[model samples]
Target: MARLVRAALRSNEYGFALETPRAIVVDEGYERYGVTAEIASVIADGAFYYLDAPVKRMGAMNVPVPFSPPLEDMTVPTATSVVEVAKALCGRL
Candidate 1:
């Protein structure tokens, strides 16, 4: 993911996409387990200047998975959600 960040920064892209099974919220006082937060920190520490826009993250909702298949499906991010996030990141929505 760092490599991808570097590449996107080197290029003229607006931003990059990050997909994870777990949600990563910033400044929620739970840094120990936030992969997105850790990655954001790395970018801020090492490649802040290269960012043309904020990093975009797409992952599961911040809730335990439901036992029911339908509810479980709703808790996780889908490809459509990711695309929507990417669109928003690019100012397309």
Candidate 2:
């Protein structure tokens, strides 16, 4: 996702006002247990690729992390939300 955003920033077609040093604020949706490391890797890549501003991460509370089937779906943001966050990041640029 961060890579997609970076690519967008590099191109003027994405409606980005700035190029780099952009901030990325994520929601609790991306904080899945199995994919936490992968998500962190994406964050790290963002930082390495001129993500100078703060890479804010807003995730759910660090309890059991919620795995109760149906309950889990509502506990985090959907894919649309994540894209919205990326769009917001682009807007900030």
Please give each candidate's TM-score. Answer: 0.57, 0.38
**Tens-digit lDDT string for candidate 1 (1-93):** 567655654473324322221222233223344656656665554445655565555455677667999887776666777777766666699
Best by TM-score: 1
Best by lDDT: 1
RMSD of 1: 8.1
RMSD of each: 8.1, 7.3
The sequence of per-residue lDDT tens digits that candidate 2 reaches over residues 35-55 is 443444555553555554545
Q: Candidate 2 has which clashing residue pairs, if any? A: 18-93
User: Lowest-lDDT window of 10 residues in candidate 2?
Assistant: 9-18
Model 1 alpha-carbon drift over 4 Å, by segment: 1-32
Q: Which residue segments of model 2 deviate by more than 4 Å?
A: 1-49, 56-67
